[model samples]
Every structure is written in C-alpha cells, then in structure tokens.
Target: MFNISLRHSALPIALFVFTLMALTKMRPPNLWAHTQFLLSYDVGTVRRSLIGQGLAWVFESGLMQSTIFALAAVLTLSGAAAMVLFMARALARLDGGAEVLLVFVTSVGMVTFLCNTGYLEGALALVGVAALILPVRGALPLIAKCVLCIVGVLIHDIMLPTFALLVGLQLFLSRDELPVASRIALGALPVALTAAVLTALFLLSPDAAESYDTVFATVTDRALDFPTRKGAVEAVMSYGPGMEPAYDSVWGSDLYRFELIYISWIGVAITLWLLVAAARLISHRPMLDRLALVAAGLGPLSLLLVAFDVSRLLGVAILHAFLVIAVVLLIDESARVKLRSVFTQQAIVLLLIVNVVVGFRPLNGYPEFGDDFPGAVMELPLWWNMPPSGGRLTQNPGE
Candidate 1:
C-alpha cells in the first residue's frame, strides 16, 4: 500500500532531467567509449566484446559515429534511469530520515552516471541494478542469478568484484535460511565460473599487440569521420594482456600521482557518507557480519592495483555499497527502524547540503569535459592541477 505522489516524485524526476541535460551539455561517448563499439567477435572472442558484438549483429556492418554515440548515450541514460527509479521506489518505503539519506546516495550515483557516460560501466551498472532488484523482490532464482553473473562478466571482467560482493552479501544475510553446504556451493559457483570465463578470454583471444592493431584499424575504418585516440584504443586493448602493462604505463607517471591524490579525496567523501548512512544497520551487527560487510564493500577496490582508472573502480565500489544498503533495508525491518530512530531531519538535511556543496568530479580528471559546477573542494587547496604530464594519453578525455 505504498503510494508515491507527484509531490514526492519531483526530486527524482528533476534529477533525471538534470542528468540528461548534463549529458547533453557534456556531449559524451568520448574517443575511448566510441572505440569500444569498433570491437566485436569478428576479431574473435575478446574481453569486453559482448556489447560490441551485439551492436554489430544489430547494425550489420558500418555504423556512423553519431549512431554509435547515440546508442552509447541511450544505454547510459537507461542505466541511470534504472538506478534512479530503484532509489526512488526504495525511498517511498522508508521514513523521512532514511529518505534523505537515499536522496544523498542517489545524487552521488547520478553524478557518477554523468561522469561515466558512454563507458561499459553504465551498462554493467544496469545489469547490477537488475540483479539487485530481482532478488530484493524475491523474483530471481539461484540459477538465474548465476547466469546474470556470467553475463555481467562477459560484458566486462571488471564486474567480477562487484558480483562477488553482491553474491557474498546475499548469502551472508540469508545464512540462517539455507544449509551450510548450500551456502558454500552457491557462493563458490559464481567465482569459479568467472575464473573460467576470464581464463577462456585470455587463452582463446589472439595476441594482444596483433589484436590491438586489428581493432584499431577496424574502429578507425568504420568511423572514418571520427577522430580516434590511439591511447584510448590501447587502453582497452591492453585488457586482454592483463594488468602488468597498465601498471607499467602509469607506475612512475604524473598521472599516477594525480589519480592517487584525487581518489584519496573522493574516497574520504564516500567513506564518510557510507559510515553515516549505514551506522545504524551495521553498528550493532555481530563482528562476523561487520567484517563480511567491510570485505564485500571493499572488494571492488582490488581492481585499483591493476587498473589506472581509479575513479571507475571507486564508482563501482559505491554502487556495491548502495546495493548492500538497499538489500538490507528491503529485508531487515529492525534495521530500518533503527536507522529511522538514529537520523534526525536536521542532521540529514545538513549532510545533504554538504553532499551538494562538495559535488562530484568526473571519473577522470579532465575538467574541460563534463559540467564544470560542483567541482571537488579538494581541487582548490591542492592547486597541483596541471592536467597530468604526457598530455592526452595520461589524461582521460572525460565522458
């Protein structure tokens, strides 16, 4: 019997429109994102080729740059809408204080969507959202969840960490309902399949350097009018070769330093919000539960050591946290009541204000791209922003 009136719905609607406008202004799907469309199974089974292959199957042959960009934008916006709707629906079931916290989290997610437009992460997020929603609604069967996990990994292997977090938390929360052996097998299934998929991608795919050239040529030839960045193309191409090349590329560079500092600041903000929002639910949980939550939440951060895209991994981590919160609120009435009691209207409003003022920067440090307002507060004090050394390769052209 939960009904959400138009008055209650205005915030999410406005935020969605705001996201659309922001994306339009930004004019995203940068060279890197566009390059992804150039890849497909035509070149053989490759990492992150699922979307590209699907696009190719749909479009048949050569596709215009504008068309590719449009498709990417549609996927990004669709994923953003899904996230917003999920939050809004969840918000309706909560009390005032919890509602405000949900808004805070949703706003951050919207900003992230804008920041990551045109990337596979947006689509991956949609898959993640679907996974979270189905289980919460008691509609997803175990076999289906496993299949979805496989689909997510095929879309992009980076999703494995988040999948781990999702599956682990679900199993942990439902521990009492399931037998010990059942829990262990269900939990291990996804991990084993993910490993198998990744191993196949590595062993089956052609040599990295050769495939990189073929992909680059295919992309450039298809979009003769589009200006493709070699670095961005290489960045994606390097995925099949594993993280060693990525590590070597960014290790001693100024880009590495900038990423370290920027993520450090953003990480603090994310940690604060999570602590405040989850304090009630987690504060009184048993030591094992707390440890499990922490481990699951930090799971995505494992990608940071190998990937130079610090913000993207962090963004995934944020999504994992949101999923954890949503699942807890959906199933644990006691936790919800506890949260309502601890958070006051005044404090919630104050936190929301701080969240707005602090704003969010792009996953990459390119200020020239994307909306300029609500820049990170840390940017002012650090003043070390010289757009990272080695120019375009080190700098991600913001989406």
Candidate 2:
C-alpha cells in the first residue's frame, strides 16, 4: 500500500484543484461570446486585465481573473511532477558533486524538452538557471549565461526582467576578468531583452487573456457553476485542449477542481521550509557542501516561484537552480562521508514526500470516442517508468 502519507503528498493537491473548479463557476455561456470572439482574435489588451474585467461587466462576476488563471492553476499542478525529474537527477549525482553542474544542465535540458511538450515555464526557468550557474567560469561562463538569458527571454519574454538582473550580476559582480568596456557592451543586451519582454507582454498577453475569458464566459453561460455541474466544468477545463485526447482512463469521470489559495499557501509554506533549510546548510557548510543542500532545496522554490507568477518565478527559479547545482556539488562530492550521508537522506526524504503529495491522477476525457482507455503517466525527462493513468474525459460536442 502507498500509505495515507503517500496519498496526501502532492497527489491531494489535485483534489484541491477539483474542489476549486467545483466550487466556483465564474459566469454563464452565451454571454461568453464576446470573450470567445476576443480569444479567437488573440488580442493583447483583453488579456491585460481587461478581458476578465470586461467579462465580469457583462456578468457582474467578482474577483475572478481570466482563463489563464485556471490554466496556470492546472500547469502549477503539473509543475510539481515536472520537478521530480530534476530531483531524481540531483540525487543520482550523490557520488559526484562538482559535476552536479552538468547534471543540472542535463536535468534542465531534459525537463524542458518534456515541458509543456516543449514549451513550458520549466524550459524558461531552466534557461534562467543556466544564466546564473554557467558564469562561475567568468568569460566562458559569461558567454554561456548570456546565451541562456537570451534563450529564457525567447521562451517567455516575461522572464526578461529576471535574466536582465542576472546579466547585471554576471557582468558587474561575478565576472572579474571582463573589462569595463566589454561589460558595458554586454550590459546592453539585457536592456534590449527587457525591451523585448515589454513589447511581447504588451502585444501578446491580451490575446491569451481574451481566449481565457471566452472560455470562462462559456463555462458561465452553461451555468456550469452549479455545485452539481462542477464535475463537468473540470472535465472540460482539465482535458479539453485544442484537439481533445483519445481516452478518459485517468480519474474516471469525476474530475475535481483546486482552490488557488490553498494551493499557493501550501506551496509557499513548503518553499519557505526548503529556503530555511538551504540557508542553514549554506551558512554552515563549505562551498561544495553548500551546493548539495541547495540543489535539494531548489526543487520546491522553483516550483513555488513558477506557481506564483511565471515572470518572477522564472527569475527566482533560475537563481535557485544555479545555487542548487552548487549545493549538489557540495553534497555529492564531499570528502566527508557523514556530511554526504546526511544530505543523501535529506534529499531522498524530501523528494519522496514531494512525489507522494503531487498526486498523479490521470486526466479523464477523450476527444473522439470518450472511451476509458488508460493514458500514459506523466514521464519527465522521458525515461521514468510510466505512471498509472489517472482519470478520463468523455467526448463532448460543445467544442
């Protein structure tokens, strides 16, 4: 038996989600046409707090943001499982800490590859991380950091501010060899990147926002808000992507919703705990020793950071990952058996808890037949054994 503790791990977080979807139905469907029309247009202003607001105007709904809010919530849940890949790699490096940097490189690379099927915050956050860690080597590291920063910016322009700050760190404080003029020249890159981020956010956010509002409007129009229909709303939201899936073998038909407050608070609490732990280890241990502890700690922070806001989270997760790599080095490469042993246990227990808590319920819904064929477990980094399919989504003609 997996045990109650195991069941309550991250897995219950899914229940939290189901509960949220069930409890709050933002608005009705026909009134959603305006929002949906905007979604079809991919307009930017609508996403900038306008669409959600506008929809509320038509519906008198309160405080509910946009569809992105729901989507972000769903992704936030997915993000927890995503970090398992990073933690697994970090643990595997228990014997070789210095090279833990490479493990990070591999972990981020692999996670990003699997992330959102190739376009997720994990990819962007990982890029930001590479920005900070790659620079320990000065010039070589500087170049690497710049490349990563640029890459992160490209992945999600919102990440520019974070990377831009890092660019400042790498050029001014970290890279001793870079001359003044060269540093100045390099400094301009972040400025340019910042501009790019602003432009993109201004231009694209509206469309995303509008599309989401439309979805919310649609949900509302259907009066899916009723406690009775909550299950159906979650069904459409969780599994209804652009091109529905082929099976509903995950959580059966009774999908649940999450409460954002609970999700964020819990994530924040866990983040703070790890932060405190890592801080203690960093203060006590040697440079290498610190790396191990930090790596173990980074998993939660990265997840929390992204969970809050992609932009801020991207910057922080990047910085944390860099530090996590250093800590990994300290723990895995430590000459002291006692120290390494302590870290090994801490790392294992921490991650195991995380995995158990991030419930891996299958998303139950199909695009075509609505049959209950099992879906694949969310395999991070593409190598872990398959997770049991969690639930199902029956095909609906509504789309």
Candidate 3:
C-alpha cells in the first residue's frame, strides 16, 4: 500500500481532491467585468479575439446562456486539468525527493492562485506557465515553446510581460550551454518577437488596438471615480492614513481588508523565499545558478510597470514566485529538501481540510452583493483577488 500510494496516488489523489473543492469555489462568469466582456463579444468590436469569441459562442448556446454555474465549472475544470497534466509531466521527468517537494509546492500554488480560478484569462495564464516550465530538448521543442508563447499572448495581451520574464529566465538558465554572443541575442528575442506580433496583429486588425484603448480608458475612469460623500476611494487608495472608511464601505470593507492582508503576506513570503533561494545559489556559485539568481533579483522590477493595479501586481508576483522556486530547485537540490521539511505532510493535510471547509461557503466573488450559491459557500478566500470590476456590463459607482 505504501509503495502503491507513493508511485500512483500521491499527486493524483491530492489534485483530484483540490479540483472538487475549487469547483465549489468557482464564481459565475458574469460576476466580473472581464468575463462579462468575453461573454458579450461581437464582430463589431475588437475587444475580443479567438478565445473571447469562442467563450461567447459557448455561453450563447441555449441552456448555457442562463446556466452561469455550468459555464464557470467547465472553464475551471478544463483549465485545472490542463495545468495538472503539464505540471505532473514536468515533475515526473525529474527524480528523487526533489520531485516530491516540487510536486507539493507547485500543486499548492496552482490550487491557491493559478489554476481553477474560473476566469478565462487566469486559465490561459496557467497554460502559458506550463508551456514555459516544460523542458526544452531540441529544435522542435523550441519551436513549440515559441508557438505557445504566441498563443498565450493572443489570448490576453497582459501575458506579454510574463512571456518576456520567462524569456529572460530561459536565457539565464541556459547561458552555460550556449555562447556569450548567442545569449545576448536570445535576450532580445522576447521584445523583438512581441513587437513583431503586435505590429502584424495591428495590420491585420487595427480595431483590436482601438478596442483595448477604449477598455483602458474605461478602467482608469472607474478607478478614479469615488464615493466622495464617504471618501471610499481616498481611503482604499491610501496605504496608511484613513483606510478604515473604504474598509467600511457597503461595497464590502471586509473584502478590501482581506485583499490587503493577503497580498501583503504573499509579497513578504515571496521576497523571503527569493532571498533564501539566492543565498543557496550564491554558495555553489555555478554559472547557471548565478544567472538564475540575477533573474530572480530583476524579476520583481517588472511589477513596477503595472503597479497601479493590485490584481496585476499580485498576479505578476505569483508568477515570479513560481519561477524563482522552479529555478532554485533546478540548481540547488538542498532547497527542495528544505521546502519539504518546512511545508510538512501534516501542514498539507491541514491546508486540504481548510480548502474543503471553504468549499462549503458559496462565498465566491461579489459577496458584497450576495452569494450565488448561498447554502454551499460564503467568502472569496481564493488567492486571486481581482481589482474592482466594471465596464458596459456592470455598474461602477460613477457609471
């Protein structure tokens, strides 16, 4: 039984259990404005591309149009399956206790934030991450990697930054295997590729840019719109003074506080983990390890560009955290052992129990309004905290 469990049931059993919990936590597609945007796609606007149009078509189907929960569950399960298969394959390629820890950490990370988030873009982000983490062996694999990068970007342009970060990490990790000049050239590839694709896409469909521009304007305008009567915006936007007002807003003060506490905790944890990983990499001082150290150090800088939005910042942070952990494990075997010791089997059991308990809440997003699954769940305890959603579909205070 022990051998059988270790060889077969360990990862699959855990993943299956988490998938069921995540399904219950899945929020209906219409709750958020971005999902709504995808749901309302039309030929007249450039707001959506292939993915959006596909989702809109699916949702428009007779029963699907009204059965919002079914749509959410399908997306969550499909994306979760894709991510689990990719990560399992990646972990299986390696051997030893390191494999055990990587499986645990990556699985927890995905269930907590990356996978089964019930958002189309979040699902695509996992696909992008899996494509990046997959081992490259030959020219064919490299070509596939590039294609996956393109697909991820086409799904959602925000992934462009993530693609660039992965490019930098890849170049660093493979530096010793290639020449100096080749490394320099590879460093520029992500930017050049992104530019070339954007230019081509614009030439093919200029209206996409127009649609995104309109969306950006709408997003910014809504953020700036505040309930001046109670100073809700000023309070939430402030990092220190007078935060209580927004925290007490009918829009859901508890949610705002939860987001602040959760994000801050994530930020601190990743920062500390990076430092510890860097120390290990510095000690051995292998070329590849050193390169990974530098990449980890520079990775957080990308968040500066998207700092205005909290969700985007957290999303980037989560991706960076995953990248840092993966690279450190590749270079330093000891780090994996350290992770296994700290995380512990009992701790994992507790986490799984917590996830199961939360699954009963029906407290998915928009709890300020009411629970869509009132008897089943109660709060948005998931890691992916979205920024205030608004657009043509939902009302922002000013709109």
Q: Which stretches of candidate 3 lie over 4 Å from their true place?
A: 1-9, 33-48, 55-71, 89-116, 133-135, 195-262, 271-275, 278-316, 327-363, 366-399
For residues 149-208, write the lDDT of model 2, one tens digit per residue.
Answer: 555554444455444554443344333256756645665555466556556544554232
Report the lDDT of model 2 for residue 390: 27
Best-to-worst ranking by lDDT: 1, 3, 2
lDDT of 3 by residue, 225-262 (tens): 22112221121121334323332343344433433443
Best-performing candidate as measured by TM-score: 1
Please tell me which model should have the higher lDDT, number 1 or number 3: 1
Q: What is residue 216's positional error in candidate 2, in angstroms? A: 18
Q: Residue 205 in candidate 1 has what lDDT? A: 65
For model 1, the stretches where C-alpha displacement exceeds 4 angstroms are 1-26, 136-140, 236-248, 272-279, 282-285, 363-365, 368-399
lDDT of each: 0.60, 0.36, 0.44
Q: Which stretches of candidate 2 lie over 4 Å from their true place?
A: 1-119, 125-135, 140-144, 158-257, 284-347, 360-399
Candidate 1 backbone collisions, by pair? none
Candidate number with the higher lDDT (1 or 2): 1
